[model samples]
Target: MSDALNVEGIIEFFEKNARHPLTPEEIARHLGVGRRDKKRLLAHLDELVERGILVQLKGRRYALPRKVNLVTGTISMHRDGYGFVSTGEPEGKDIFIPARFAREAMHGDQVLVRAERGIRSDKPEGRIVRVVQRAHQTLVGRFEQTRKFAYLVPSDPRLGQDIVIPRNARGKARSGQIVVARIDSFPSKNRNPEGTIIEVLGDPGDPEVEVLTIIHQHGLPHRFPGEVLAAAEEIPGEVLPEEFSGREDLRDLLTVTIDGETAKDFDDAVAVRDEGQGRIRLWVSIADVGHYVTEGGIIDREAYVRGTSVYFPGRCIPMLPEHLSNGICSLNPDVERLVMTAEMLFDAEGVRLESRFYPAVIRSRARLTYTQVRAMIELGDTEEISRQGEVYPALQVMKTLAERLQERRRLRGSLDFDLPEAEIVLDLQGNIEDIVRGERYFAHRLVEEFMLAANEAVAGFLSAREIPLLYRVHEPPSAEKLQQFQEFLSHFNLKLSLRQGQVAPRDLQQLLDQVAGRPEERMINQVMLRGMKQACYSPENVGHFGLAAHDYCHFTSPIRRYPDLVVHRILRGALGKKGLSEHEKQRLAQTLPEIGEQTSARERRAMEAERDIVALKKCQFMVQHQGESFAGIISGVQAFGLFVELKEFFLEGLLRVSSLGDDFYHFEEERHRLVGEHGRRVFQIGDEIQVRVEHVDVERRQIDFVLEGAPPAAAQGDVADDGDS
Candidate 1:
């Protein structure tokens, strides 16, 4: 009777009595609903039924959906026409939908599915009953014109169907031109989707057009709205004297910002001092973005929608307007800026002794690059040190403190995967000049340690006081995934010990240490990463598994990440003597869950868009090197073929199994290899070989490779499985 009017209360009632379907009258009686609240109870039940959370049986009886072999989730489509529906639960298995049973549901669509099992099948399959919501109302594709009619070919392969365009719907879109089409009608069992061309971009192969294609494909907001821009213009460009009231004045602190050479927005600056007896005092100052972008304002709403900034090869789509992100909120050198500072003291063991947060103002002494810091501190460059002047001593102290922190983290079994990243060099026309491996410097790690410490300190400070805020949580991997990973390791004659069918971070770290310099090191690292769960934002604290931190949150880059801004706002509210009022706490309790989910989805979207553009660029760069041979390693293996990564450049290509002309190869699923039945030749992951670039498809962002001496085989046979890379 406590929450009788709430939807959760109704769901809880059904869950407890799952085996018995109850009518509305019986449900009301069981929940002890009063006559005055009877209508409210009925409304909650109706809403639940509408959302597929509950199903109605004969005689007007209602029950939980899962109790009747039904599941609700989003469907992910395969390029080959099949699809899978994720149950949206942490430990739920995906329901496989074969091509014929896929119906008209498209990728990312929320749908209600009826679960079933096929003969001799070990896994469950599903048939979509109804689609609750469509993921895409408009999509980016290429328009094709025939003699009689026109259609649009979707840029994303998972779309799996072309869109028919009526004669009158083609608005100035020519043949072979990229366009954005709004779907007027969705697909049926026998017909394709119908659409109208709303916007026509330029032809394909153009640099700007390609970039726009990726942006539109991901539904990213590239340009600021007019209202948001106008709101940003109202804010002052410099810190005013009156704006510094009730703020600590740290303008004379020996602070400096370390970032890459091309960085424009400096969000965090650090200063370190060595106290006696191996004690250190650190100050991490972040730009006070909340000061300008108030809650529910136009600019704040736009930032919330964008969630985070998207960075491409040579461009960036910022969350906020340049007037704010690049002007007032940025910690430019020798300029007074408003900031929220995290001050902490650590003892000899790198354990934090005390910490506090406060609003402050600071004037950065210098804006140094990572390369310069590395030269001054690690390389001991005389000229670089002389050029740094007074900042050199601070850099030295920062280096020492960072080493201590790194050692402490390592002892706690933090997993660090030192994977290579590609740095694409673009010329004036945005054409690739060269592709090289990005260098990792000690200076980068030093700044990283300081930021991590600050983030942890802030999270601990707020969580200890019972504040409700978004947390950055990374949950542990599932037992099934770990078992598969263990099976894969058995091939290399390695074993991962598990206790009670569970794996700890230390177990994975030790495995990595065992394979430190072996040939299979990179492959094992990648596989381990894939097996782990992705990190996301949540209002509930579950502790970060990867960083080995019991408490963690994003607090460094508020200008780019919305979660950080949310944290800053919450921290400010708690800094007051009264803390958050009861009403304020209730409001946040109702809103933070949705905020966390939305921000997490937006972060994933940005990451996918960035990766898509990079893959396209890599494909474009390989176009000039056709028929060239390069030394490579077998990075992945599947039933379809071998994925080879080149040593000369950070690029991967697929060598189809059919291309092996000398023998018929059989796939070994458990061992991750392909073996020739007649020749007895085998190819497995981590094997070194030479490969020739056979083809490059820029539009699909795909590359094909062939054995160096093998004759060109017929068109690749039907792909039996998905290939990696």
Candidate 2:
């Protein structure tokens, strides 16, 4: 039996019944302690209070700290030394903690905090009482040596404090070099942490070294282990004859892949056929990654850890090694590859009549680029169509079906927010060449419509039978966010109908349509998009709001996404003649929630890493173009600065209010603009103006700009306003 005086057990009891505070006598009775042991239990409770595990009320009642208005959450620190704790509650309210109350808690650290509601302002406040876990044991930063002392300044701005490096802990790191340091001691409230330099990266000015620093800072695995490489090498290059048994033979189907010019892994392919009487049969073939990488295998575990493939400026960190991702699993032309097929029959009005899912072995008829497909279907280029004999006819029919599906989605109020995405250009040595906005054509939309149809069909099939699986769910926006968005739009004379504390997707669709082609179109669309919740994976079906679909799952691109691979496996088990066993079904039900959370985190991490690299490269490109003037649109306006996006280049920079030639500017938050008191000039969102690149700070990944035609302070007395900034 456990000890009767166990302090941990006493704390656990309070934690388990945290909602109900218990007096000393009640706690003693609940612990089954007699009068003789009551004194010992009280002593233990006092000790727990001392350790911040429990709190004693004014009436001498005991309770868990969380029960007494204290909460637990992860802290996100800022460069200015303050932090915000995210409690992950449905209300989405973050608790602001002052720099003094942080108690040395680092960024990403989990901590217990005492919340003070509606005290200082409308926003809630919190104080860190105890740190539950540390997020970092090693740090990446630049090393500096003084006359008699040394220190490391962290590369991540959120680290909040520098680490002191003792004389002996300097290792071989030289001054002004980037190095990885292992923390020898965590920080106290009044003292900075100490660390030892372990690995010395090269100088900070080198491009290659900066990229490596980013990878190391984010804890990304850049190289495969020896065992994993060995395992990848063991896989054969060709599909075995025995592997095709019991699989549908789709070699005769006119299937083709449409991807970018540089894409090596073609995981999805499309085919179409006219069924006569205004009907069509569409096939979406996705590479069967589950067939090659079994569950709990080395490669599978690695893929799970990586989550998704991360694409940088000129390189890719694939989830799987090249042997699998680009070779066997890729649906290369003329190669027999295993795939899972979703065959759906649709009427002329783009309503699904029937759908079927099955395992299949197929040889891709041709590898087509988005440009080539657009040339045939939209541009009607005879040369492009003649290049592919039988596949050309199938492509034409696919276009017609895609158009119908798009029209159907339009009627259903599926939102299509066309935000411009930037694509960075690089030279052979990985240096910045240029930045260009991503283009959209009919070919891109056609492929997207077909994929969406296949995903919806597969998801609907499994959902109808109540199977446990990870679904890509996009929930509706929270009421608080919607109300804020409505207030923001009210300034522009637009009204959103909020009914019964909820708004429909069509309401947003109508608003977007009303503002189309206006100067405020981009601003309104961006704010509305921000008000919506991000799409994430969940075992519980919440439906997809953005897609306007009752059921949706990602079934294509299994080679790049772990959830897609898991979906393929589940479908394979369920499609068999015998179906799944009771044990298998129960196991899936028990494990899918955790997998949903894990894959969601991994996807976010990959996206963040990709975004960081792009920003880094963009900053590098701007260094060469400093002082060059370009036409730009005001993307954002704040109390301090205006954010401008260049027209000819996919780049954005900030123009500080201080650079406006001695005018005192005041930010008007309600109208989303800034006004100068002396000159009476105004700058607002969506106003086109000319700006010159003033400065670029590569270390901070920031670009600064100045207004191109602003007069000097001596000559500003008689200038006309022109109603423009």
Candidate 3:
């Protein structure tokens, strides 16, 4: 028996043979126990049966029973209720949990499962016997009140099960109203789980209703928990002198914070100055959130579990309270704040010679938005750079330095992906007003280059120091995808060559440069981008293929992301009095990879939520302009239909191939298009055509259109807006 176990002497007899079949004679020989003791232990083994751990047979064979292998993992459920358990197994394939096997384990649940190796299908499958932890018990959906009971049909299909409410718990839910429900339980004998109507959102098909659905679907807190808010309110909203005890004093240095107009969490700032003999020193300071959120503290643990702040277009689910995230931790102009600074000295060639990171106290002299910076770029008059001239001249110098760094990076084969990101303008009541894109200018580029350089420098230092930290790694796509891309691109007379270990970022960069100023440039660039893998954080350093950076980590936004917090903590531990223990280091090493995966998944979900909202808004916008013809380019072509992007407001819609009037279109897989058999009409990606809005589907967030004539006199009756570039 294990020394840790109680009643060891008699248990020793059972443990000797792993509680296998044993006659009294054999048991007596193993434990040197009397017949009486053997009988007593046998009676105890019978008691263990109550826990389902051990079983006894007619042959007196007492062995460990076939209890399911108790594994804990997050559930990834599908629309149809079936899901898979994403076990953080380094080698074994993920276990599939069939619809019935889920056993009420909702999506993202940390479930305890008893899995056996059994399969009638190709994939491995497992059954969930118990749920260790529920990711969320509350869900968002529309309530349906029948004569007898009510039901909450969830907006997120991932929930997979409708919550049924009996007459008493139904509340005032009408026949068809949007509502949030709190799950009570899934009865052993019932098909649906029971829940209570906790909130009434609104009627279905409302603009804000879609966003609320997403917020509830993800289980994001609309605001801070009461205790958290109370704790935040208790803390002062200013940096205290005692808190800056050991931090380096850089408040005297000129620094400016740059962000979007709506951004309140000003967590980063930049400053640059000529050091001597054509060398410059650039400083990147990030808000020292770690100083406020201490280890093992309530807020700290919550932040760790969340991993990052989630940003919606019109809202944000912040990691820290606004009093901190947008107040004390915010590097507002003319106010002293604690920061974690990365200082680097660079030569005329933009090659960094020295760098170091440490805690510091800084005062940002100005708060500049992208709009103001863009205006400055337009004027070409760098006079009004910052609120104070002290920070303004430094910003000009920084912009010059950042440009040089960008040139250096581009020369080093870093691919530039300046994708068009759109923003939604909502009124006070959260109604979509307009969708506008950011003006691509030097202002945005300067900020990006500086942050990229700082992140790269920190990443390099961490790697050189052999620090175990998370690095964002982007892997090259599989050979199969590359070959398919090559074949697909051949249709456009574009040839892309790929050889083993010869996939240089510079090659793609050069291709993009060559395709510049062409109509098909954006389409080809998007396709090439899709052929690359997503970048994610991991303890192991796998160089980022897109950036061509040998080392890359996120050290710029500790306010938004958790890995940055870990980096700050590690850097502090490595260089400060608070040295990390070996046990803590080991724990980080074991946990980081899994946490990275989860955070990356959440990031994707947030992006999708935003996209889904935007798509819905576009559909709403289209509903108002139905039956009007607008010029559009084919975004996607399928056998069933074609997705078209409207030229007017940049909205997208799908044109059903069946509605193309008496023509049978066959899908040409090789060409990524559909071809009409009789009319010789063809619909392929990037084909510009005028289409009248056919229908708008609010629930599905889809727009249907019917194809009309060709491009509006070379795609819109005018010299296609030169500013489009």
| Best candidate, lDDT | 1
Window of ten residues with lowest summed lDDT in model 3: 716-725
Scored by lDDT, model 1 comes in at 0.90
* Whole-structure CA lDDT of model 2: 0.86
TM-score of each: 0.95, 0.91, 0.80
Model 2 TM-score is 0.91
lDDT of each: 0.90, 0.86, 0.74
What is candidate 2's lDDT per residue for 294-328, written digit by digit as tens?
89999888888887888887788888889989999
Per residue, candidate 1 scores C-alpha lDDT tens digits across 118-141 of 556979898887776788899899
Tell me how candidate 3 scores on lDDT: 0.74
TM-score-better candidate, 1 vs 3: 1
Runs off by more than 4 Å, candidate 1: 1-3, 17-50, 56-62, 669-671, 714-721
- Candidate 3 TM-score over all chains jointly: 0.80
